[model samples]
Target: MSGGEAYVFAAYLALFVAVLGWLVIHAFKIARLSRELAELVELARRRDGKAPAPDAAEARVAGQ
Candidate 1:
């Protein structure tokens, strides 16, 4: 390949890597958020002195 073509390829590769990195970061964020949400749900159940209820939890999450 010509030098100019090589540079163009490198630029596209760099862009792809950057986008991949961003997706990975967001994936981690989503995981963290889910964990935090579950913790909060459990805390609420304890404070109310109720046993864990799956349907109620699903409805709460859906309402939000």
Candidate 2:
């Protein structure tokens, strides 16, 4: 292949690698957030000494 064709192929491969890396990093972030939310849910359950409610926390915040 010509030099120009080789350069084009290399550019495309680099772009593909970058996109895949970004997807992996984003997935890791999502997993971390999910773990944090679960911890918060557990803390809330203990704080109120009852089962967690979907709206109860929001209502408490609004009332404050």
Candidate 3:
């Protein structure tokens, strides 16, 4: 391949890798947030002295 063709290929590969990395990072963040929300639901349940409701879980996730 010519030098210019090689450079273009490298640039495209770099962009693809960067986008994949961002997607993986975003997935991790969402998982972490979900775990945090589950913990909060447990806390709220203990505080209220009853089983947690679906609405309560939604509210906690919404930061209400």
Ranking of models by TM-score: 1, 3, 2
In model 1, pairs of residues that clash are none
For candidate 3, lDDT tens digit of each residue in 1-64? Answer: 9999999999999999999999999989987887788788788787989876767676666673
Better of 1 and 3 by TM-score: 1
lDDT of each: 0.83, 0.77, 0.84
Candidate 3 Cα errors over 4 Å, as ranges: 52-64
What is the Cα-based lDDT of residue 39 in candidate 3?
A: 81
lDDT score of residue 54 within candidate 3: 62
Q: Flag regions of model 2 displaced more than 4 Å.
A: 1-4, 51-64
User: For model 2, how many clashes?
Assistant: 0
**TM-score attained by model 2:** 0.67
Instruction: For model 2, give the 10-residue run with minimal summed lDDT.
Output: 55-64
Instruction: TM-score each candidate.
Output: 0.74, 0.67, 0.71
lDDT of 1 by residue, 1-64 (tens): 9999999999999999999999999989877876678778877898899997766765666566
Q: Say which candidate scores most in TM-score.
A: 1
Residue-level lDDT tens digits of model 2 in 1-64: 9999999999999999999999999989876766666668668787989887746654554354
Question: What lDDT does model 3 reach?
Answer: 0.84
